[model samples]
Target: MLLLSLFVQPATKTQAATDLGLTVDAAILIDASTGKILYEQNGYESLGVASMSKMITEYILLDAIKAGDISWDQKYQVTDYTYAISQKRALSNVPLREDGSYTIRELYEAMAIYSANAATVAIAETIAGSEKAFLELMGKKVESLGITDYTFVNSTGLNNKDLQGYHPEGTAEDGENMMSAASIALIAYHLLKEHPDVLDTAKVTEKTFREGTSDAIVMKNWNFMLPGLIYEYEGVDGLKTGTTDFAGHSFTGTAVRNDQRLIAVVMKAVDANGEGSYKARFDATKKLFDYGFTQFSEQEVLPAGFVVEGNESIDVIKGKADTVNIATAEAISLMTTKDDVAKFTPTLFLDEEALEAGVEKGTVVGKIVLEHAEGKDYGFIEGGDLTVDVVTTENVERAGGISLFFAGVGSFFKNLWGGVTDFVGGIF
Candidate 1:
C-alpha cells in the first residue's frame, strides 16, 4: 500500500498555464474544502465589489444570530433612515413602511435576495444600533479573517452618493465598497463553511418578502447562474451579484457537484470594449466552473497506513525483534487534472541512526516528500512539494544481555565462516 499522510496548510494561490481569456479585470476559482486556488488572474487587486459585499453582511448577520446578539424571529422597527433609503428610486429596496415592523428574518431575506439597501440599514441598526457601529464590526471581522485589503464603508455595497447622509460613518475616500477578488472568495468560503443553511435562502428563485400584508413585496434573486435563470448552470445556488457605474458587474458564485464545492469570483467584468456588461461576469464565472469540473478532479494521492515499498521494515538494533514494520499514519488527497496525475512522485527519507531497544510504536522517525514533476509548459503543483511525517508501526523491546551476547557471537562466526570459504575457493 502507498504510505500516505494528510497535511493541512494555508491555501496558496499558484499561477498556472491555462488561460480562459476572461473579460473580467480580476477573477479567481477555489476549492471550497481544501481552499486550493485552482485559477486566478489579478485576484488580489482591490476594486469595487458592489453587492457582493452583501455576502459579508450576511456573514456578519449570521454570526450575530449565532452569538445570541440577534434572532431571526425578533422584530425590529423600521426607522425613518431606513424608510428614506427605500424611497430612493435609483436604489434596490423592498419599500419598508416607516411605521411598519418586520422580523429580522424578513429584513435579512430582503437584503440577501434583493440586495435592498434600506433592508440592510434596518438589519444593521437592529444589530449594532447604527450603520456606523455595524461598519466597524464589518471592519473588525475582515481583520479577524486575515484579509488585509478591504474597506467596508456601508452594509449594502451602495455608492457614497446613494448613502450620503444615511451612513454617518462616511465612506472610504473612494466611496464604494472595495475588496479584492481573492478576499471576496475567502469571505464566501467562510460563510458557506460556517452557515451552510444560508444556501436555503440563496437557492430560492422567487419569494414574497412581506407575505399577505398590505406592503407585500415580491423578491427575486439577481444571480443569473441560478436554476430557472436564463444562463442557469448546474449546481449553482445562493450567491450575490452587484453592478454600479463605478464597479461594473461583479459576481461571487458557488456550486456543488459530486460532493465537491467551488467558489468562483469575477470582479469588474466588462464587455470587449471595457464597458460594464451584466452578462460578462456571469459568463466568466460559468467558464471557470466548467474548467474546474471538467479539467480537475480530487484523487487520493496517498493511502492511510501505507507501507513504504522497500523500507517497510527497519532493523532494530539491540531489540528483541531483528526488525519492525512501519507505515504512514494518515492519507493524503490532492486535486489535480487527469493529465497532471502522472506527475505525482514520492520519495521516502528515514532517520540514519539505528533504531535502539525499547522503541515505542507511532514514533516519528522520518518523513516523505511528495511532489509533482513539472509538465512541459504548465506547473499545477504549487511550490512543487508537500511533506508528511512517517512513524513506526510497532514497538521493539530491548533484547536480554545473554540474547545480545549470543546474537553477536553468531554474527561473528557466520562472517568468519563466509571469509574462510571465500579464501579457500580463491586458493583452489
Candidate 2:
C-alpha cells in the first residue's frame, strides 16, 4: 500500500529531460506504486493497439472467474464462428476443433500465452454469448476507469478487414481496436494492481496446453523480456505483446527490482523502412526500465509519531497540564532522485491559538510542510511538496473549581504588582 497519506504534501513538478531517444510512435514509463509517470512521449495519441487488447479481455475474464460468474473448469464447445476466425492466416491462434470441448482455463491460457484469437472468441462467446457483447462489457469497464479515448471492435484485436463479416449485428465494419500509450499503461496498472495472481499465468515462459490429449498444443510466450528469452531482462514478468499491419510492434511490459515495480508501454515501434521492427519495441522497453531503476529510488520521508522540531508543544489554557506535545499521524514515503535528496527540507506549521481545557489527545493541532530548496537544474522540486497532520500527544483536563479560584487570584496579583513596579520606576 505504498500510497501517500492525504496529509502528506505532493512534490512540485520539476521537469528534467528524460532523453532516452526512443524510436516509437508512443511510449510511457510509470511507477506502479504511486502511479507516477516517470517518462512519456506521445502517450495520449490514439493508434491501433492490436492484440494488446487481449490484456483487457483477460481482465474481464479474470474478474468474472473471481465473482463466480464463470469457473475455470467450466467447458465450452467451439463453434463455426470461432473456427473460421482461427483459420485466418494473418492472425495468431490456437486451432480449435468444431467437435472439441475446452475448459475456461485452457482457453484462457491459450489466449494469454499464445495470443490465440480462437480461444479468446470461445471464452467471449461462452461468457457473453458473443464477442460483440463481451466488447460492450469491455467498453463499459473502460469508461468506468475514466479512460475516454478508445474503441474495441472485437475480442482478439484482429483488424476488421480480417474479421469483416464475423462481427455481431450493429457493430461498425470500419472499427479497429485503438488505444493510447497512456491508456494501455493505465489498464496494465489496474490489471496488475487488482489481480496480481495473473502474474502466475504471465510468468510462464513455456507450457503445454490441453496436455496429454491428442489435440495437445504447445505454447511459448512471445514476450522477449522473460528470463530464458534472447533479450532476457532481470526482474521482467508477465504482460502482453502486439503486432499488425496498422499497429506495428507494441508491448506492455512490467518488471520489479528491489520491491519497486514499473510498467512500460511502447507502441508502433518501427524500423527505418517504416516496417514493424520486432527488436525496436523490446529495445525501447528495456531502456525505459533501465532508466527508471537507475535514476530513481523510493525513500521514507516522514515517520509516524514524529514530533515537529520547533512546534512540538501547544499551551493548554485552564487545563491539568500547561501544554501538550504534538506529533504526526502517519508515515509517508516518495520516489526521489539523487538531486532531490540534496535539497530536501521540512517546515512545521502550528495553530495560532492555544488549546482549551478538556482537550483530548490525537486532536489536530497543526501540520508539517515538507519541502526542498530549488535546485540550479530546476527551479521547482522534482517531487511535489507534502503535508502531514500534527496531533496532540496527550490529553489536558480542566482544573478543579478550588484550583481555578487560586490560579485566578495569583494571576491578578502578579499583573497588579508588575504595573505598580513600572509606575514607581517611571517616577524615580
Q: Give residue 109's lDDT in candidate 1 (0 to 100).
A: 86
Candidate 1 lDDT tens digits, 1-428:
33333332223334567889999889988888877677888888899998888887889899999999898999989888888888874688888777888899998888888888888888889888898888888888888888879877788888867764766565654488898888898888889989998899888888887789778778878887899888899999968899887788999999999998899999888778877777888889989999989887897777778776677887789999988887777877766676766555666777754588788999887777665555222222122445577788889999999999999999999999999999999999
- The TM-score obtained by model 1 is 0.82
Highest TM-score scorer: 1
lDDT of 2 by residue, 1-428 (tens): 11223344445545446678888999888888777677878887899898999998899999999999999999998888888887764477777777888899999888888888889889889889988798898898887677888978888887777774887666677667998998888888889988998889888888887789877768888888899998889999979999887898999999999999999999999765666777888998998999999988986767899875555688889987888888988876666676666455566676646888898888987777666555222221113346688898788899998988999999999999999999999999
lDDT against the true structure, per candidate, is 0.81, 0.81
Root mean square deviation (Cα) for candidate 1: 6.0
TM-score (all chains, Cα) for each model: 0.82, 0.80
Where does model 2 exceed 4 Å of error?
Answer: 1-15, 272-274, 303-323, 342-389, 398-428
User: Model 2: how far is 320 from its true place, Å?
Assistant: 3.5
